[model samples]
Target: MGESTAPILRVNQLNKQFGTGCRQCNEVGSRQLDKNYCTACGTVHACQQISFDLYPGEVLGIVGESGSGKSTLMRCLYFDQEVTNGEAFLTPYKDGSSNLFEESSQQQRYIRNHLMGKVYQNPVMGLRMDFSSIGNIAEKMIAAGNRHVAAMESRGSELLEKVHIPLHRMKEAPKNFSGGMQQRVQIAKAMSNNPPILLLDEVTTGLDLSVQANVLDLIKHLQRELNISIVLVSHDLGVIRMLADRTMVMLDGQIVEQGLTDQILEDPQHAYTQQLVHSML
Candidate 1:
């Protein structure tokens, strides 16, 4: 076995705020002024002084209630949104390391298309509702320059099997599946290119408890076998415990507490974390 090492991702002093100038940031007022409060209609601080690392094959869960900017942070890491300041890095399980923000736009696009994948909170949004599940996955594969359509088709089937979705449903539109099934299909699509890192945003939020358990199990199993790093964002501590090796607790755009999974779970530090734990119990 390979010796355990450092994080696959490292971020330091990451600061991102919406809008332009202080006057604009302030016009919106103090209610929105994050501690790192920017100077305009600073809709959200998004993230600030957010330093952390993610190891290869480790699941790093981001826990924050709604409006805490977890999604925005995730988007910034993937370059979906602009990051105002600091370092962001990712060393994939397969490729040379890269500074996500420092890279050229072409390089960033290449990484987004070929090495990283993201799943949205709502499955419906992750896929093209008009296309069949197979079409959706294959279309993405082809767009990413998977030259052989046959190989991609075969791979898509394998993915479907892994997710326990029936092969026959491949040609069927995702609009027909139950919410849980749709989620599984989206997982299959996201994994189509075999990315080394995945962003799972509230993947199980809407499912029933039983289905949620199964989805969590599936995510864990896939992570182990694929040797992929994952950033799982969830407000649910139970979900975090099920999949994360480490946890980061965020409140209003800042990471208030972060550490190994057990440490955070057994003895949380921040008052917000304490309150969250109390609410859960």
Candidate 2:
């Protein structure tokens, strides 16, 4: 992605916190908290002034340890968790003039169905285990107002095949599939709407090493073939290295470093990021 290319998605000053803010924690620039939490107020700032731009046909990786707010950030973007405050603009929605966070729930639903797709870390969160793999894909299509059964079936089958899910088992529920296979089904379902943006939160976590590679490879292939923009969140730097063109390092609910993947790997500036890079070596 070039600097001149307008961002497909832009997020500004995003914040998500739990618990009511006390005066000590609400002092803004003067507040001092332990990491991202306030002992005095018992408020956990999951994400703080998080901002970034995702360009078209690019993969922007967010890497951080657990509790560093990477997953929280993803959840906020997907509207799984309501943000305390933020503004996100999507070029495809309202000409990028409206803040998505301020949109009505109905409009957000439309955006989720037509403009973006998300594959959660846990398959249970993304898929209805009781529904057939094809049926899961059909559910998303239905949300997008797709009414043609024949078209949905054809699209579902095509997507499942693209993700390497066998057509023979398309009618089987995800509960019967292996962890990796279930993840693949989730990916297929997320892509069912042919959305421009895909949000993947730890999609390969908990799988065997071999399975991880397969799922990652499938994602890379799909991104190239479809030219879709992706915001990929993972704790594993290796995964980020393999797929992300640009990378952001988050620590304590803030972005500590961000740049091209190669530069960050070769010469990390932040102590936390350096530690993360060294551990991957």
Candidate 3:
């Protein structure tokens, strides 16, 4: 990722909050709250004024503990949840001139199908458990307007092979596979449409150590081979250290620190970041 290269994805002041705000918590400068929660209004600010750029072929890691809003940020980007207020621009969409949040629902669906692919932390969220593994990949391709059965079948087989899923078992449902295999199937399905941007939300979480290593290796290899931009969200710094070029540390629904992954690991600045680094040590 060259610094001179333009960002494939740019987000500005992205905010996602639940519940209506009261006068006490509505004020911009004077709003006081417990962490990300507004005490007076009973509102939870899941993401607050989040902004970042994802360059082509770059893996940007968002690291935070649970409830720190890292996953929420990913959800907003993938259009799984609507943003309260913000603007996101994609270079492949309208030359980055239009804010994706303002686009109609139909247009947003187009963006989701063609421009972005997301693998959720849970395989169930990303896959149809009852559908065959290859069928899941075909579902995504079909959503992207692929109607040719032979082409979809060929593409699905290639993707399954890319993720190291056995070709013989391509007809099996995800529910019949182990956790690691199911996640791999999800990866294949997500990549089926050849999306430019991939969102991975704790993709390796809840797996055995060996399984986690295998999944991480698959993602690393696939990202390099495809040269796709990735926004990887995880609480594990070890995972970020292994995969991310740059890191953004979020705390209380805000970015506390951000810099090159090596720099942040060596000399963390923010108090929360320092604690995180120290914990890893």
Candidate 4:
């Protein structure tokens, strides 16, 4: 199954809405929402009928301006936010028959610990700022069922080294680290479980240009080394260009265009996508 051409992850008609389904909100069709918001019912149609596939060892990029629902889509996939409606499947879960969104909380927690890794745009969202760097990674391993302290400690040390975090700081809290370092630690913690799919949301958003380059390089290297399927969300085209194998351009909570990254950049088909491409030039 590892070498099968089937996608590692599949999503269908995913939707996330933040409001009561009042008559007023129901009257505002998804197509009519302005910038993902409905004026009539004050509803935020964060993600509307989003659908996509992520293949093994593929870097699938989701790009959109703020409020375009890219981040909302990620949050939904990671179960950070509940999906109002949709189906998500992991190839390895119940032999691909189970819908992730419908799983029990216990089952969802297990899957989150053992099957997926998520890195948030903000370190505070991903890391325990008050905990030692080693502690952060250990928390993941613990969730994955590691009971031996010595083994977890050793694993944490090794992952920290892998992410280029200095060993001397293993006992230091991440609150004292720079933004780049905090992100590295977050990556290390996310990878601790060795999940087959990684969800990264704006991992390089606020870092220095040089730091962003280094982080991007590290991601590429790890993708090759681990062969993990990656879902990367970013508004930055350059980041998408540098990493994604395929790109999806989103607008107003809809996928305006999607294709090979180069094709999307060089021959955008949608008006919104064309505008994005032209602005990048």
How many clashes in each structure?
7, 0, 0, 0
Segments in model 1 whose C-alpha atoms lie over 4 Å from true places: 1-4, 23-43, 93-98
Candidate 1 clashes between residue pairs 3 or more apart in a chain or in different chains: 8-54, 22-39, 24-40, 24-41, 25-40, 25-41, 26-40
In candidate 2, what are the lDDT values of residues 36-109, reduced to their tens digit? 99999899988988999999999999999999999999989988889999899999998999999999999999
Candidate 2: TM-score? 0.99
Candidate 3 overall lDDT versus native: 0.95
Identify the runs in model 3 with alpha carbons over 4 angstroms from their true place.
Answer: none
- lDDT preference between candidates 1 and 2, better one: 2
Which residue pairs collide in model 4, if any?
none
TM-score of model 1 vs. true structure: 0.90
| Model 1 residue 86 distance off true place after TM-score fit, in angstroms | 2.5
Higher-ranked by lDDT: 1 or 3: 3
- In candidate 3, which residue pairs clash? none
Question: What is candidate 4's lDDT per residue for 1-281, written digit by digit as tens?
Answer: 36659998999989889986556555535345557777777888887778999998999999999989999898888888889999999998897889999999888899899999999999999999999999999999999899999999999999898889999999999999999999999999999989999999999999999999988898899999999999999999999999999999988788888999999999999988889889999
Clashes of 2: 0
Worst 10 residues of 2 by lDDT: 23-32
* CA lDDT, every model vs. true structure: 0.82, 0.95, 0.95, 0.91
